[model samples]
Target: MAGLFISFEGIDGSGKSTQAKQLARALEQAGHEVVLTREPGGSQGAEEIRSLVLEGDPDRWSAETELLLFTAARRDHLERLIHPALAADKIVICDRFADSTRIYQGTRSGDLRNMVDQLHDLVIGREPDLTFLIDMDPDTGLSRAKGRGGTEERFEDFGADLQHKMRAGFLELAQQFSDRIRVIDGTRDIDTVAADVLRIAREAVGVAKSDA
Candidate 1:
């Protein structure tokens, strides 16, 4: 509870992963202990689950099934990496977290708010101290993602409509939790975006250190 738990979230190609890494490096350079991790794959077992969730047969996996799989991996990640790092008072930077489920699964599946809420209550008992939501147009993100020429994962393979919904969901979530979440313009230059993320994280770290 004394450590800072930060999560970065956005649609594909929003550059949150890159920002998260940079922030972690900056914190380390400032003489702070840091733990960089990601959801759906942080621990050994969770990584395997991540493969199933991302590279598995899409037709075979229903919405509920996908939700469970994501949560399963998250639970393992929490037990193995996240919780221990927090206990050691290390700044934990995660690429994605439970909000992803609410945006991707809950929005895509429809009427899954209750499901997301229940999972949050049961599994993610502690919320991130700060959540940086890198906001960008779905079309732009998808174009950049495709231009990268990488193998498409399950989520990446989702149709444009679903991606749009997910983007909207993220924006809504940010609005609802404005005090704990900061919505950054992901379409900005990488350095600019990184600077913004760092500023937010620095403030959060200062508050957390003071509270400790």
Candidate 2:
């Protein structure tokens, strides 16, 4: 691809979404062409799937089923948005990507990580060139997620135990993909965190500090 691909990932309410937007805006102000999009909803078809997977009951879909749905949505997103944007030499800033599915669905029950990896190899094979994993306290993250009071509570409804597990899983995944994943503390204030995120993003996109 001709463009930089970046993704923001974290447990629910980890402020990754906010950071993704901030990074996008900062990069845009720096005169970079950026496409800020999210998984499971970047394309029209994927958006429909997002409502199905994110807004329903926690038990509405099995881990295996979610893997399929997420893969389908991701395929659409890649074909319709991500690939083209990158081909156009535009920076792609995604709020979440395959890593989210790998952690959420891969470990939702037993060890489906192998299956997730195999399916990803078979379907959605692309990964972000750079990823920002916002590390946060699971307890605080769950509380913040639930307090939002939205229909996307399906994952949040899984409760604190899962949140803790997810936080650990994400950190482990960061280790596994350490070359591309950057871990950032989410406990800091928004501007501080955004400053860190923007600094790293600027570096990855090869924008000199003076240019920004």
lDDT winner: 2
Candidate 1: residue 158 Cα off by (Å)? 1.3
How high is each candidate's TM-score?
0.96, 0.96
Q: Which ten residues in a row have the lowest lDDT in candidate 1?
A: 150-159
Task: Report the CA-based lDDT of candidate 2 relative to the real structure.
Answer: 0.93
Candidate 1 C-alpha lDDT tens digits along 96-201: 9999988887877667878987987897776898999989899888777767764436676775777788898899999988888899998889889999999889
Error of model 1, residue 93, in angstroms: 0.2
lDDT by candidate, in order shown: 0.87, 0.93
Worst 10 residues of 2 by lDDT: 203-212
Clash number for every model? 0, 0
Name the runs in model 1 displaced over 4 angstroms. Answer: none
> Candidate 2, clashing residue pairs?
none
Itemize residue pairs with steric clashes in candidate 1: none
Candidate 1, backbone clash total: 0
